[model samples]
Target: MVEKRATQRHRVFKGGTITFENSGIACTVRNMSEGGAAIDLDTTITLPQSFTLLIERDNFVRSCRTVWRSDRRIGLAFVQ
Candidate 1:
């Protein structure tokens, strides 16, 4: 597959949260880069198209939009 990401991703396994409109869901940071991330969510339930991803361990919080999804994994692009 062609490399389409703006930044190279680093593998990770940090716990995180996706929050939107008073709703929050648990997730795991599977990988990350300057522009985006891949996360594994605990549920297959639908999520808002836009949300905030908070990874406390990394002291990171980003506004994200759904890029893709498969099973419980979601690909997100950081919103600028």
Candidate 2:
């Protein structure tokens, strides 16, 4: 298979939250890179066009946009 990512992604299993306005949902990070990440969300609630991805344990928060989705998982690209 051909690799299409601009950067390598490392597998991860950390708890995080997806927040938009005053709402938040829990999710788990599946894999991550400098550019983006794959996260497993508990629910398929409609998220905003752009929202904050917070991994407090890692002290990480970035503005992100959804790239794709399948079932309860979604791919996110960090906005610089």
Candidate 3:
């Protein structure tokens, strides 16, 4: 298999929240890198074109955009 991402990702299992405006949903951080992350949710959802991802334990917050999605997972690219 070929790796297509610009940066390597590391596997993770951390709680996360996807928030836009006043709404938010819980997610699990599956894997992450300096450029992006892959998150898993409880169910399929419709998210905004862009939103903020908060990983409280890591004190990490970043603006991101959806890059791809599956049944209950989403790929996100950090906006800089």
The Cα error of candidate 2 at residue 55, in Å, is 0.6
The predicted structure with the larger TM-score, 2 or 3, is 3
> Which lDDT tens digits does candidate 2 get at residues 1-80?
99888999999999999999998899999999999999998878888899999999989999999999999999999999
Highest lDDT model number? 3
- Model 2, TM vs. native: 0.94
Least lDDT summed over 10 consecutive residues: which range in candidate 2?
A: 40-49
> Compared with the true structure, what per-residue lDDT tens digits does model 1 show for residues 40-67?
9777978887889999887899999999
Number of the candidate with higher TM-score, 1 or 2: 2
Q: Which segments of candidate 1 are over 4 A away from where they belong? A: none
lDDT comparison, 1 vs 3, better candidate: 3
**TM-scores of all candidate predictions against the true structure:** 0.93, 0.94, 0.96
Please give the range of 10 consecutive residues that has the lowest summed lDDT in model 1: 41-50
Estimate the TM-score for candidate 1: 0.93
